[model samples]
Target: MHNEVRSVDGGSSLVQAQYIGTVNQQLPGPERVVPHETPRALRRLVGRNEQIEACLADQRVPLVVFDGLTGVGRRALARYVAEQVKDRYPGGAYYTDYATHTVDGESVISAALRSLLRRDGVRDEVMPAEPGLASLWRRRSSGAAAVLLLENVTESEQFLQLMPGGRDWLVLVAGRVESRLEVREVGGETIPVEPLDDEQAAELFRELSGLDADPDDPVVAEILGYCGGLPLALRNAATLVVVGRCPSLPELAARLRRSRAELMRSDRGPNKGNPVFEATYQEATEPAQRAYRLLGAYPAIDFTPPVFDLLIGLDEATSRDILAELVLLKVLQEEHGRYSMHPLVHDHAASLSGLDDEETHEALARVVRGFRNAAYYADAAMIGVERYRVADAPEIADPFSGDRRANGLAWFEENRRALHELLPVAEKIGLVDEIWQIAESLAAYYFDRKRQADSLSSLRHGIKAAEEAGNRAAEARLRSLASRPLTDLEQFEQAGDFVRRSIELADQDGHLVLRASVREFAGRYHDLTDQPELAQQRYRESIELNEAAGEARGEALSRMFLGQSLGDAEGLRELETAHRAFGELGDSRSAARALLITGQVRVRTGLPGGVDALTAAAEAFQTSGATFYEAQAREALHGALVVENPVEARSHLDRAIQLYRELGSPRAEKLASENDGGLDGAES
Candidate 1:
């Protein structure tokens, strides 16, 4: 979640209005095995119910333009609205801030398309031109459903190009407007978000500051006057009182008066924080100020305590404590253990911290180092065929420790968006090495989620970086990594070419581990292309090379894939051996794959434990967050059960088809076609 401070709407009805919310949900490329909770619920949205209800009522409208003053809760309103109706968009509700950073050269349409395609699980390498990406979004969304909250869009032309070209999906565009003209030009119904009325402001202050003052109290009115009733300033004023910087609300009000008196017209302009941020900044403790400014350098999204540790280079305990203090001050909001700063607050902090370029640069380096290490370790845990492992990196605390819901796969899924955002940030600072490392580390998650496009995108970056760094071994490995996704995408010729190039590079560099790994992809391409003989030969060569390199995981997987594609008694022997290797290595996904293949072979031989083996494989895949593989295991079971138990087989096939369709895999067509109008061919 980008910003999480929604204000009360005082129950004003909307003729037409749309609010922008930042996207916080990760793709299945991010969702992983299961979601542990619902979207974070609102604490209290004052003065915003009518606007929300009106937007919900006008479902056919498809687009709503939320025009409001800065700090008046536009992002908050959008977030509130998304939470209210997310169920309607089964594809998921997403938030993105297209507030255009300095080096973001893409057109507004390109940015919008990127957001939409990313939501649809299309990674950047496969990302098409604007029109085509939008077309892909239209086709995908029309069939399923989606919601996008686009924040910081300044013109009608921006959102106009992003409209679904149909009415099935909903988009809310939020921005500050000098007039309703832009909103009118976009043809969206406009919802103007006003500041809180007296009653709401009083309630908000008491809630935030622990103040007992009533609505009619002179002190309360005086404070609200300086805040202009904007939730941003009002909350900052209340924070001053709550944090003991002011002895009372009256003192806070007086301080605000002095700050506004000192402000130049330029400093008090509309884009400004109305002198409130200045007063709050002046009053905050030194540590709090430093934490706030450092927080601005973090990504524009929800983050965890460990991220703070990365941002400020503080120990985890101190970093977490600082964040907790900010939460109490209403400068940050905590939801289900993740904390987010309102954009206005982040902007305010960012504006003040322009004096420390060197420290800021080092802080950013810490962030890169942290992400690179996390991605490396997380990938290691998820997949076992280790071509390499990052050695001797600093031990960083797991950011997802607060939730207790993550293993390797779940961790990758959770941080997918954050990692994506960090790629550009690393590039901007010339952390070229970190950029490719992070991208390569995330390859396993993208592969399992069937996000071939995303995998290819990351691999391309790694390849470019390796070439630039003149690291032939890394270039070969990246080429091998790049081909796996191409194989998945069924671009067999393209995949094989990469494999061939990788082999040449590995041979030139005498990289044995690299050669072994690239050969596995080569074998897979042959296997997928129905040349089982060629696949078997390639797998044998891979196994020989891996054995020479002493890579147990690679050797085991080569045997598993070769045996599975062969479908003979000898194959079963190989699978059993591979399964034992994976299980002993604690690599659950590969273990599951081996078991699934062995189970199918067992069923062919009329063995009693065929279903049991497949069952265990499914369970393993589920626990490890290999959802697509889980579905594949289920499909194999369906095939095995078709002869002995038609009813069970139908159920299994139904589930497999459902998952395949959801993932948009071509396997769904084959599975559905094989079912052929209700299992009419079942029985021996």
Candidate 2:
């Protein structure tokens, strides 16, 4: 019996069996091969008209390969061509990314086949195994006129495995220029996709930037030249302009000229830099090549110039020159004076056979140590010197020299992701001391920013490392720090347990400041759990311990908490004293917290000047990057003003909602829901 094929909507084909002879058995037709939708193409194609026309010039060619340097827009061009000719193949256009789908350098042809078959109504249990996938695919797709767009194809064999057996089928492959020879042997026509021309690059930049300027303008010309006619570079440059990073064309041009590196490096979409970067690295200067290899092994996502110098073991000027050269080569990307490699480029650089194991390990160790030292300095500058800190601040030149507190907090905020990335790397290399110490340094920043989840995760890791190294003081500090995030996350039982353990550890270790800190956390846990009397007792104990240890900051902080628990005239007096002490100690952030609590209590009790106090506190928190507290102050101000001035109250609520949303706080949604349908019709 033979089957007659019928095309259906959505690129599926049905079959009807035609039986002959005496036997009257009707066999089921082949399963419908439901075509996967083609990958989304760029909203607009730029400077690929010639390539598109060539690909479509001969409709009879079954295979077409668009090969070029990475980020030259090969994938985008192929996607555009496939979309344009989609109607020619009724079986529909199917798409898959080979780079994403492959496993351990082997093409996962079975996954591709299974995806196609499953979508075509094939049941999972009835599906064929790996060896049978290609046979089934060919059998099912025999008469189906379809288009296949295989992106980032690395080998010709991958193409052969997925190729349909029909003469009418068209396969469009996109990969690096090196893949052209292998694909050509399989009758695939190679189309070399070059960088955009000057005019096209200029148009793309103008379109993306939403800027209207003469093409001959000096700044515009400088940008175009720096982009080197690459669409990826042009898009990123335009992004920098649109985001107000450079503010104007001239500023962007000057930045480009000064750094000789693309400021805005994006790894979005199919812009992998590995293929072209490998060749670029091979041709770069020895110093630039060494920088690339070492940087690839660097754990952090990005680094400043000083850190770069340390990592490369070079002097300041020499390292800067090497960085400029690598940036000019497009191997390293620099953004706002910090240098980093694209993840794909980093992977390639790391894979290169340059540094031996010991050299790489030592280089990475130096970078980690540099970060640790800087973190300790920033921590001290931002929060004052905490006696509970296990690691001493190394006697290095201070990185944050001016406006120490502001700059320290700013540095932590800027490198937060890099700091988080370094933890596992440090742990892997047995830098246990560094791991706990870095986590300890980040605790205050984390708490002020309301990154409770991150705080909890980092503290847990630090606690583990401290315990592993048998460092009781570090373990005690980390455990006490864990309570804050746990309490904020509403894991009250866990928070209380951590507080108890921390108190015990501090006593056993015989550290007065550590014991004071743990006592304050215990008081916080009690307050959160609504045991005001017990909370006050813990706070009083903490105050005595801090005073005994001559730690005025800890004593003042505990007094602030004690005042909050009191919630009366005496409580107000305590808050006033704590605020004054913090101001005298030059700890403005802690002063602001004390003022915030006082304002909150006054607002709740309908006291005068509550709004004024909240407004001042909010401003301070905003200035200090204490985003969570700022939101709290805003919420308090809204509550205080809602009855008397609904319009102003709504404004405060709006700002609070925005800040909470930015911080990923659930309070954002809660406030939004509570205020929904126009707060007292004031919004209308």
> Worst 10-residue stretch by lDDT in candidate 2?
675-684
Q: Candidate 2 on 329-381: residue-level lDDT in tens?
A: 55666678887665446656766633446767777778888888888888877
Per-residue lDDT for 1-684 in model 1, tens only? 243444458865444335565855533354322111223546667778788888878456667777655567777787777777777775566665665422366676677677656655676766667557666766655654567777766556666666664456677777644335655665567787766787877777777788786868887788776665677676677667767888587788789776632221112234353543554455457888888877776665478777788788888788877776666455676788888865456656766664347777788788788878888777766654253632234376544333232466678777888887777666666777776788778877787677788778777877777777777777787788788788777888888888888878888888676787777777777777778798788899989999999989889989998777777788888888899998788776678888887777777677778789988987886776566777777787877777788898888788778877877877788888868322211100
> What's the C-alpha lDDT at position 4 in model 1?
45
| TM-score per model over all chains | 0.55, 0.60
Estimate the TM-score for candidate 2: 0.60
Give lDDT per model, in order: 0.70, 0.78
- Candidate 2 overall lDDT versus native: 0.78
lDDT of 1: 0.70
* Model 2, residue pairs in steric clash: none
lDDT of 2 at 617: 87
